[model samples]
Target: MLRIKKLDIFVLKSFLLLFCGTFFICLFIFMMQFLWRYVDELVGKGLDMNVLAQFFFYSGLTLIPISLPLAILLAALMTFGNFGERYELLSMKAAGIPLLRIMASVVIFSIFLGGMSFFFQNVIGPKAQKQLWTLLVSMKQKSPEVDIPEGVFYSDIEGYNIYVKKKDKDTGMLKDVLIYNFSDGFENAHIVWAEEGKLELTADKQHLYLHLYNGEQFENLKSQSVISQNVPYRRETFKEKHTLIKFDSEFNMVDGSFLDRRSDIKNMREISVAIDSLIAYGDSVGRAMHAETMQLTYKPAQLSSSDSIKLQKEHITVVNVDSVYNSMTSAEKLKTVTATKNRLSSLASDWNMKSYITQNTDSDIRSHQSDWHKKITLSLACVIFFFIGAPLGAIIRKGGLGMPVVISIIIFLIYYIVDSGATRIAKSGGMNIILGTWMSTIVLAPLGAFFTYKSNKDSAVFNADMYIMFFRKLFGIRISRHMFKKEVIIHNPTYKEDWEVLEDICNSCEQYARTHRLLGLPNYIQIFTNNKHDDVIKDINQKMENTIEDLSNTKDHIILNYMNNYPFLSTTAHKSLFDNRWLNLLVGIVIPAGLLVYLHIWRYRIRLDKDLKTIIKTSRDIQEQIKNQHLY
Candidate 1:
């Protein structure tokens, strides 16, 4: 058992607060998206308060798996980012706490959260989905509220089309109404035209009552005679008329068990059972089909006793189809050919249908398997995203919703796109369902690990200056001089001593350049083997630093500029012409062995040559300046 320290408690408290806030925020966003997708089923149903409440409750539950991982990512990012931004992380590091140690509490908490997420997915998620969909189905089945719009045909009522030219909102009266009633049958439809009408739902909400004033009803009458060409019709004029239409506006819940058979609504055990059952069923069906096909193609003939006796007396003979066809009449040949074509066509159609059904069943099985893997993969995503987010936050050192939100959304979108694409491929049986479902995890986990490793080392992973310097070195670009504020120095009488020190430094650089043989293949081999050159460079850098400290009070800008060039000289020595044995080895092992390696080595040599020349020329110029200023 591990004991929690105060620091751990502090870190966890901050993380928990952010996690809770982000979790609810994510959940609400996901719930809104869910509502948008199913709004059609939910809207205008006049659902009861209890029904609506249950829907929202289940919807939130169902969205937990999706929202939880995103929340963890954002919260972890924000928490660590704030620490880094405020230099709290630096203080913790200075206290001898490693990044991993600082993260241990949150890592443990993330694991616990992942476990809970799994539980929710396996247990609560299915129940919520079942209930939510049950309510949705009920809502879809419930009739819409009666609000007839003017200048449009209203067909919400079954088997009837109602049109209102104008409606009075205050009086609840429809003006210039036209009703086409086809509930009895299309041939017996009744068309009613009314100057005004009032529509009301029955007390039980089972039917609609329409009372019309100054209305005319036209009904098509059915003919008793089958041969009757003209149909009889009836027209009735009424001062006021009332009619009842069958409409069930009551909310009715469907059975939740209807969706139980879906794989998404099952736990791991249930999913395994379903996968096994599906595989076994598929194999059995394939075997049965194969056996049936074999039976059809080469079925054993049943012989009677007389036929067997005849066959025993005579040898069996083979018939040649071509010779038999040649001997047949033209009409007979045509008939035989047509029969064969029709038979082949019928068999092909039957086999095609069977293949289609098999393909569809296999696709469905893959989809279910993918969903089964998704249950575990999504839970695992929480831990993976936490690792990624925490390390990334430390690297970026940005807090608040601005930068963190942008980065989190971008990463989540990438994960979603990859997961979705792989899922589609798995559903089509183009890839293994397990592999497809875990593709994003496989890709992102290594990235998280890399970020963790870098963060632990306090690497400048996101530092633009580091990458810029790298590119500059790779391209053999000249190092830029560092800028300093212009200032006047009072003392400058040590010019002769400075010249001797600069000459010594130049002699040391020239001697290293000559002794290392930096221009040839020996330089390449030296990169792989450690030599005294690195130590020599370090000594020279220390000497340069001491000399610069001695000349700190120099007033000469020329000497100051030459001193500034010391950093460039040190950099050239630090990144010697030949270094990084692994890179050399890799380049050597490639197909064109040493082609790229040779180019790089040449670039380094050229850069070193230029840096040495600049160092020598700048030292000579400083000496000339000292002599010209009569400082000796």
Candidate 2:
């Protein structure tokens, strides 16, 4: 937990970066619709910058709730990804920290952030939405000049297309009116043509009046009386001939828990408490059963009518036989009857036990019970995903937008699709919500654990060295230990042969090469064998030692070259290279300042070589001793 606290700064930074990135991306996409809807209405009205800014700020807050969770998930992926990519995670592991412990901080951060998001969704979001819509309505109605267009037909403002054929320069009166009303459904929908019309403003300027001198309204009235009358009106009044344009569209309010409207904060708290209790109980039960199932069965001793009748029939048959055997000796008859009764009782008991076993194995009860059980399983998905992303970052040991982005997308997509489908099924009341949401996690949790375990145990499952080996197998390429140059053997006498030592050396060299690559060092060195028959154990060890030394020299030389060349470049080019070199240098410094901080690392390695030499000498000496003993 202290370690988790220590990582707060890093976790917070990652969360903020991810949150901002997602928010901006969402803003850019949604802003166009937002601006398009209001831009025309605010053009000539002299809209305040403060109002627009406030609108956007409130809108942004509403958007943050949905965006934050996605951002957190992506951020976690990228953070661990960077750690893995940079080998910082590997370094942590090498220092004796487990991957799960390292992820403790991220999990804590996500939970806290998730809680914040839930709050935002419930409280700030509703207020922001209400304010945004109210402001848009206020801005639209106050200014008529805002909705009027000079040339184009403004149909988008309302359902009718208002066209001005001619206009007065002084009064701004639109003449030769043509109004196309498309709102009243087809056929009844009609176009109004007027010989002369003028635009006038009401006393409040809140309403615009269209005054007509002479106009004929075209309509297909189905009533015979309306068709026969043929009425034509040419009248104009102050308020009678005005269209009250209501630009305000009703907006829905987001009010309550994410899952349910009736769900209050208190209800959520209760639900959380209940969930915790249920999870604890279910987990204990599941462990006891050694399964995730939650069903149990027992049989009552009460017999059904059919069973009673069958027993009665068997008894009556025995009684009838006894009645028929009245003349038989009493002792002999009693003994026969007792033996028969014991056999019948034993058979009935066996059948009852079998029926009880069958009744207890019912899956309907299990499925119904598992519905709630599924929720507990699903609740742990977020934690399991952390398990996957964290250690994977450590294993892949490369984190940047490139790999992290790709991996995050794949993982999140899989999670989202499964979660969504399951939720939909659960909501329709067909399946359990918990099971639906958690099915993806349950399937993937073990897979992630397997990868983490393999990584911790230093398994070569995802190790890049395997690729080289795979390629060699596919291409049938072989490199012999003898073909590679052999170093001079240093002599000593205490060394002894341990065949198992070969596997240990191979694993070490593989790990060393991986660490070197992560540190941005040159060529990885590891043994590649096409044959297991011949032992090249000593040869592989010698080559690995030489390669590691070479890797160090190669990195030092590259650093030296960059440092020397940086002083002699042109201004613009120099700036570009300088920026890149500085980043690289900062990254490179980790290898020496961090990995090589212990002088004993070098000393211990040197001791390994001396021990190997001693083992060789001791083996030769032992062989000589054995030969002399045989001669004696």
Clashes of each: 0, 11
lDDT of 1 by residue, 478-523 (tens): 5665535347656554767877988897898888788765565544
Compose the digit string of candidate 2's lDDT tens values, residues 1-632: 25435445665576467656755764565666567777877666555677668777876765664445345545566777677667766777787977666666666765665556556645555456556666666666543343445566766545678777677777766677777766665545566767666665566545456665566666665343434556443333222243454342322233323422111222234445544654565556546554312332343335579957987977743334555468678897898789879978986886576555434432323333433343344345545655666566666666566776677668767876876777567655577655665677767789778867876675666677899988964443445321222244243212122223333444544544444332223121111111122123345445434433332222222222322211110112101112354443453356654243223223333433344444344333433443444421
The whole-model lDDT of each prediction reads: 0.83, 0.52
Top model by TM-score, which number? 1
> How many pairs in model 1 have backbone atoms within 3 A of each other, for residues 3 or more apart or on separate chains, i.e. clashes?
0
TM-score of candidate 2 against the unseen true structure? 0.44
After TM-score superposition, the amount by which residue 243's alpha carbon in candidate 1 deviates from its true location, in angstroms, is 1.3
